[model samples]
Target chain A: MTSESDRSRRDVLILGAATALVGAGLAGPAAAELKTVVYNNSGGASADAARAAWGGLMRDRASSNLLVTAPASVARLKAMIQARNVEWDVAELVSQEHKQAIRESMLQKLDLSVIDLSHTPDDCKDEYSVVYALYSTAMAYSSKIAAAKRPGSWAEFWDVAKFPGRRALRNHPVDNLEFALLADGVPKDKIYPIDFDRAFASLDRIKKHIAVWWRDGSQPAQMLIDGEVDFTSGWHGRFFALAQKGETGFGVQWNQAMLKRSWVGVPQGAKNPREAMQLISFMIDPTASAKYAEGIGYICCDARANNHLPENVRPWVMSNPAIAELTVSANEQWWLDNGELAQRKWNDWIVT
Target chain B: MVRRWFWIPGLGFLVLFFLLPVGAFLLQSVLDPGPTFMHFERLFEGRAFWVSLGNTFRISITVTLICAVIGFLIALRIATLQRPYANALLVLIVMTVWISLLVRNYAWMVLLGREGIISTSLVALGIFERKTSLLFNEAAVVLGMVHVLIPYMIIPTYAAVQAIDPALLRACDSLGARPAQVFSRVLLPLSLPGLATGCLLVFTLSLGFYVTPAILGGRGQTTLTMLMEIEVNEQLNWGFAAAHAAVLIAITAVLFFAYRSKFGMDRLWGQEL
Candidate 1:
């Protein structure tokens, strides 16, 4: 009986080992045969939209599988590049981070031939990256407030006597510094290389009147709709999305909006650089860009995408001539140089 | 020898997954880009770090103390209950822990917002002349954290209280001790080790909290974890983040050792050392 049991156990062990070896061998070659381009972006609605817009195109054009990952982190990018284990083939970067990555040599130079930028603005193109979309940090208010009483400008928004309602600003330093400078009557062109002393002084004047300093991207609009605050600084795209859905409880004021670019780039040492470049090219195709813009309520940099958009959506797009004329482009180069010190100062200042 | 071999899998998992990664990350504090104390020096020099550290300790202590008082009373009640009833109540308490932390925080958000149920009811009841948002403040953060952590406090205390011999209490009563006197003298002392363990667990967990404070709190509520997040995510300063983590780990270790020395390690497992 013992010998019979032993013989069966030996046969089972040998069969199991053979199966494992065969599985490993198949996985090695199969993985090599299939090309996958990993695209990491700020997840949520944008990621979903990108997958819908370009995932199929990437598969058809590049013959590569598209993998998506969440909430882009520059620190992770740095760590991966430093370790020589880059995981993302294509990654999205905010304007300041785009500049910072270039400075640190963490991004690969774009093959402009593969990624056409003929319709893209000159300002949107760079040696290592291209601005794919534009979003604005603008003031939004509850629709319950009358138009006459609305604080139209940053200066007006700061005037507690005129507006006479609860207010919330973003807890971060980036847009708040610019807003403070504008509120202090600094011209839009003169806002860069920020005058910190003047800006903080302006912030001090209105700090006590502010009801809340919001952190999350969703907080400002939610606060507005819920009537937690009558006015808040929020991203324009959030309010635009709500408006598109016919939810008019919140109204966005595009006047003096801080226009920020969202960039796409290939990271250094990407496994499939050519496929990553192809994916970028696919993302900026007019039809795909329009669909992505309509889905997320953010305007793509390519002006031709405007032709594909519905007439009603054009006014909401930041690139429309009328809206573009009124907005200010944030100086990302200045932020790239001084972001760390600015953040430290902002953290100290907010608590105090 | 056969039993000793059984430890290999568990010990190997801890060493490979926990110890190696944590050790390497912490080592980056001093060794990254070369051996230097600049990260620590920078951390000490920053005023925000100190402010956040103070907020972290203050919030943790408050949560721990509140949990201890409330947890002990609940535990005492459960200890005296019939077996099935006690088990049912214990299951209910543990069930709350199974709910997503994000869901709980969002529920609190709805309850505490300006036009939320709490604010509207309070205004209608004439408790306040105007509706006020109770969210995005220190109180909301404490409340959210206490809700999540109370189970940790109750479970350990219940075990300790259940381990108490009923004869000892009866003996004390026969010796002419009052109800309050029995509690203060006998029950409290016997349950001290369990209470200590619960406090340590809750306090350490509270110190590392990120979501509760971030979701429910305003500008003034930044904690050590939030500061570390900003460093790692926004500033891309890994070495500085490593330094912050190292400090947090050191403080936790010290508190643990202090607890271990006072209570003896076996009390952690509901036994006398």
Candidate 2:
């Protein structure tokens, strides 16, 4: 009887060990799979587009698996990083914010070997971050006003007497300061380490003329569409989306459009780093990239993607001499250094 | 004993959802990378932060005073009506309460915007020269808030006014007291608890309002809630955002206690305010 009891105890111990081994086996692949969490600035529409772009790559059975999720806001994602519980595997961040995140050491160094760069433009491919998408902040004016030779550049956009209608600008300091400096005759390539005093002085000149200071990409577009304002600062995609909806008598001037890049970053301490890189690689496919650009009304960073684009929209999507002059690359480092101060000063100035 | 077990699930739910989240959020305010007062110090240093703080208090006080006075009168009028009329009026007040706050705020926005009904009417009536944009001003913010908050004020006032004994009014009149005197001496005093309660409710709610201020008062107007929102949403300054939220919650608690003590509100059962 004592031998039988001893045998039962042995059996229990063996069963426990077997369960532990099976549990570890189930968890191992998920652990090995590189987990990438991406923070998308756009709402549901963009989230859907990103998922579609990544769906095929993730569907194929591979050792490295992809995981995609978007935080409700950039702030929540930043909070996670700040807390040192960096759950985000990857994030789609704005140009100005990308600089801020890098300065804070919340991001991981990009490994080119993991990312497929075959379709990436020479200018866009970089050691730190690859420019994921290109969009413009251009002057959008009413069609009625467009007939009146509406403002062609930032200087003209700020000239109340010349443009002669209610104008609106973004509420953000980053783009607004650039627009102000440009109006003050600062060259597009030299709009960095922004002359804050000069920019604010210039901004003050047209402050009263601005009936609205838009807070979102959609606002400036909506303002022009509804005739709430005659001229406003707008993103190309927003206006493009508006144009697609109907014959909205709104047209854009690309002459002095501020070109900005939206970048994707892999956060440090990601659950699945390899999968994140693979997903990032899959997202840059020229054909898939072009399809996304057309669907979303923004240009992809992949120059080869331009070939797949429609003939009519090709010029708008690709980098050319004309497009280059119209675009201004924001100095991420300058903004990183000055963003907090600029924001504080902007709030004080607006309130006063 | 059987009924006691039924409460276990509800107790668990509260512990899991409301209590746990709030406790965690409160913990985040002070106990950051390390326990520090840095967030609060930063908040106090900025003039914008101080100004917004003052604005929040000032607006909430004014709104609460206006709501209480107006809500009390309406409640009194409804309470004095004939049974059928009072019953119908009660239904209307309840319906207003039932309507979503977002829808109400939107309705008020249409009434107040530059191209909205009010501006259009004023222009047609030759009250103003050009269409004035009321879309981003202090007046617009207050107007939006009062509309959304009036129902909260009215319901509580109605209950208080309804509960006032009719015999006391008759007694005052029999003793040669004027209507005004009777109101000042008895009716108003009796309703003080309710009035204080409603004011407290409106004041606390208006303190943290976001959408009304954002849509109606767009720029050059912000409250603590808006500041917290910007920090979390745009700036991604969660430490600052958490501090702001913590301060707002603390202020709300103080206001709650102040209201309770002032009117002996703690004596009443099932009176949230």
Candidate 3:
């Protein structure tokens, strides 16, 4: 019985190795013909928008295949880089993830000559990454509430007695801490290196008032549309998408909006770094950026893209000077340093 | 010789696909970067870890108890019914399991939301003064979990109930025992093993629940799995996440062994040990 089991195990091992070899053999020949640049980004409508914007452009212009992957993850990036098996040529990093990636040396420095960022805003450009799209965690309200009773700012949002309604906030520390600080009367510029004590104190006041602590990006806008919530802190693009669909029951308040940048960077040890840079350059081209923005409500950081945008799209986008002025950029560096602590505290606070 | 060969493939699959990766990942809790208990140390230091751990056990126990009670009743009813009726009822219970868990959770969200059917109907019928959201609470999370996990409970309990000898039940009934007494003495004891198996299944599944709680539950429903996700995805602290996973694995292993010792392995396969 022992001999039989040992022979069976050896046979199983041989079968596995043969299968793996066959699989690799099939993939190797196809991969050698055309250079593939895997661009990993947050999937769903955004991925679709990206494909619509540059799928043809990457193939036609760069003579490379654009293989888009889903739900961009910094953890996956770290693993890939650590294992010395980098799969993604270009990866989209959400908020402070780029900073964390850069800190860990998980990303390659951008070759500015290949990826032209001169047209991009100075604040949006980094040595290792560039902000491709601009979005905000902004306040949105249901049209069911009277216009007069609508909360315009964080302070007003906290005043539950005045603007009484079911409210939802994102179930995270990133934007909520800033919102708490702002509601506690911290000036927009002064709202960095956050005082956790003051912020939590402020949050403690409005804690019971918040009906839902929404986890997903789509939840806040959907909640408003469903009348599940009257006021919510949600991504601006979600509300914009709904408005574009002619759903007029919700209105976004841009006042004190937490302006966030979506970054794209080449992972360190990527196979096709040059092609990846070229793809990034193509993505930020004025026409391409404008088309992408139209597909999804998230505007690219390129100021030149504003010229190609239609008049209707201008007021809604972050690139508009009027809207841009009302927004505050979150301190990504601070978040990079203290994210774990903030997460722990936030988790503790919520449960207690 | 053929049976031995069959064992190799299954054993190899488990070793390669499950054990090797999981063992390496769990090892990271101590051995990551260097050998240290820092991750575990930090885990214990945080209130979030303790609270979420408590929440996980509390929710799992609640879900297990609820599933056991409901499942036993349903199984008992089905066992007494005609074969055709019983099969149909069992199929209906099993059908819910086929639906995606996310779809089911979202359905509950629609049903329990502020302007949802139940809320609106309640208000219209004057049962409620106004539409109030029945969602974003521990109750909603439990309801969602119980909905998803009920099938796991019912299937096992039904098997055990159907296996019970009708003659034995008749033997008790003919001894001038009351209907309640017969059930209490014979059927209940006979069903305990199945109910225990169901409870184990439901409880363990509940411990690892992530999506339902995140969607249906509010601030209070943060479970260990949810916390682990934040650690892995948001915090990018694999060592810490591994520590969380290790703790969960340890508890589950302990529970599994206890179950195995109490009810021998054959009981798990519907054998009356």
Candidate 4:
């Protein structure tokens, strides 16, 4: 035990000496910069876009000290928060996650005072989260079945007689349940207190038609490419990515689509909470948000950002007003209250 | 004495990497933040658990049976062949084993999908008026598992069949026993040890298979692994996931012991197995 204590003391002495050496080795006093890490699940192109926007903004700011880092998974972010080693100053969370995180007291409350909100959408700014990305879970159909018309709404999507072929749905219960409920003739406004029995009954009606229940965003898209099924529910951004490569083999309709927002939150026990708040403030800036949307094919509700976008890409990034009006916005607070019951019902319904 | 020092590092690695994580996860099965069995009770009550457990066992048994028949034949061929042919056959079996399971499953998917080569050809031949897809179904899952597991069956059967003395077969021939009699009486009993080992290996693997069933199987065809994944990733219920996994592990262990005694594979296979 004495030897162990002595060894630790020697190690501490060495660490202190190393720190002193590093302090002495500096060429000059460095500028005071707040280094903040951002946890993001969108790793490939979206992360690059986030980094690019922040890199320029950080370079120009004299007193504005900020650094952003993006980690990949919510499970990892949850671990960091639980351990109180929250390296993420700001994190991108899905709507359900944002709601759950807030309920769990995992996030620090957002102070809107630090942010410029003159051009921000009222829906985007919130007490606990700021909308980072907006995408749609919409309908898509294969063009291979030449006789079948494109499904424009949930009702039409469910009209197997008119659009006859095998169908696909995501493995998750969230959007699919909503769509099924909608097809069962539940009004969009009343979707909140979901009539559980009716919703599941509606799901059962079309269960046999569904040939593939995909796990990831990419799976539905891959299924379309693979011709695994004739029609499916899909994300618009993924379809847009495919459409950009000339003529897409499948088509998507924005009618009755569900719009989901990804939000950024700072953990309550972040390693650098102040730095994280600064990064969050920067993220809401119209210019930065616009650039991110442009690169990632997602919508950010900075009105200024939408106005500044390249004309060709703007329509794709922000849902056209006509298209946007047709879709229902997910009520995350409702989900927070009802998720457990809904998840249980979903599991039992699927098994049955 | 030298091995004792080596064992310290080896045992340390096992305890740190394997035992610690497993122990922690197993503890999570019973002990939640509030110290309750809520998660396990929830899992047991859910129909998904029972359905997927049944499906997992059903697939494992089916795959094991198919593997035994096909692998036994292949191993018999290899054992009876000349040296060069036997070497080539062994290399082929190893090659199949070496290929990635994901790659093999994807290949099967391509063959079975709507616009896949098979479907296209069938359509062209007027075998069907429209393209028929078989991508996500129980059949595809079983076919993929069988293809992947054949090598497991083959290796053991080959080793077991090879162990039977040539002189035994010669003695049977001298006694005017037919080839069929020799195969049933002499060869089949001698190779039973290997067949038993291979079936168990394939069966255990199919029970735990996640990726194959997830990619290939459709609704009502999902397995225990998929259910466990849904619990962990979608529901974020690690406790329930752990309990389900523990149940699967326990079941597999029980089966292993039962099979070991019934077939005497415990003696025939190596100690590590």
Best by DockQ: 3
Q: In candidate 4, which residue ranges exceed 4 Å CA deviation?
A: A1-39, A43-72, A80-90, A108-128, A144-148, A266-282, B1-9, B81-92, B95-99, B263-273
CA lDDT of each prediction against the hidden true structure? 0.85, 0.70, 0.85, 0.74
Q: Quick one: best lDDT, which candidate?
A: 3
User: What value does the lDDT take at residue A238 in candidate 2?
Assistant: 71
Where does the lowest 10-residue lDDT sum fall in candidate 4 chain A?
Answer: A1-10
Q: How big is the positional error of residue B181 in model 2, measured in Å on the Cα after superposition? A: 3.6
TM-score of chain B of 4: 0.90
lDDT of 2 by residue, B1-273 (tens): 798699899999999998887787767667765787888898778776877787788778878888888899987897787656765775665556556666777676566656677887899999988776667677877887887787667666665666677878778879999988988999888877767767777888899888777766656676777777776677766677788888888889887787667766552332432
lDDT string, candidate 2, A1-352, tens digits? 0111122222222322332243232332244434334434465345655666665566573343344455434565666765777666667777767666676676777777888776677666555556677877888898867576698888988787777888888777878999999999998778777888999999999888887777656677666665667888877877765565574678878877878777777777766676667666766767767666665556567667777776655555535446766677767667766777887787767655
lDDT of 4: 0.74
Tens-digit per-residue lDDT, A30-63, candidate 4: 4555443544555655666677666566545523
- Model 4 over residues B1-273: C-alpha lDDT tens digits? 787597798799999999898888878888866688887788888887888888898889988998999999987877777655765776666666556678899899889988899889999999989988877777888999999878777777776676566878779989999989988999889888788988888898899999888888876667888877766755567788788888898898898899877976553333212
RMSD in Å for all candidates: 8.0, 12.5, 6.6, 10.5
Candidate 2: DockQ?
0.10
The two-chain DockQ for each candidate, comma-separated, is 0.22, 0.10, 0.25, 0.13
Q: How is the predicted docking of candidate 4 categorized under the CAPRI scheme?
A: incorrect
lDDT of 1 by residue, B1-273 (tens): 789799899999999999999999899899876999999998899899899999999999999999999999998898788766776787777767767788999999999999999999999999979999998889999999999889888877776677677878879979999989998999999888778878988999999999999989987888989989988898888788999999999999999899888887876554441
RMSD (CA, Å), candidate 3 to true, equals 6.6
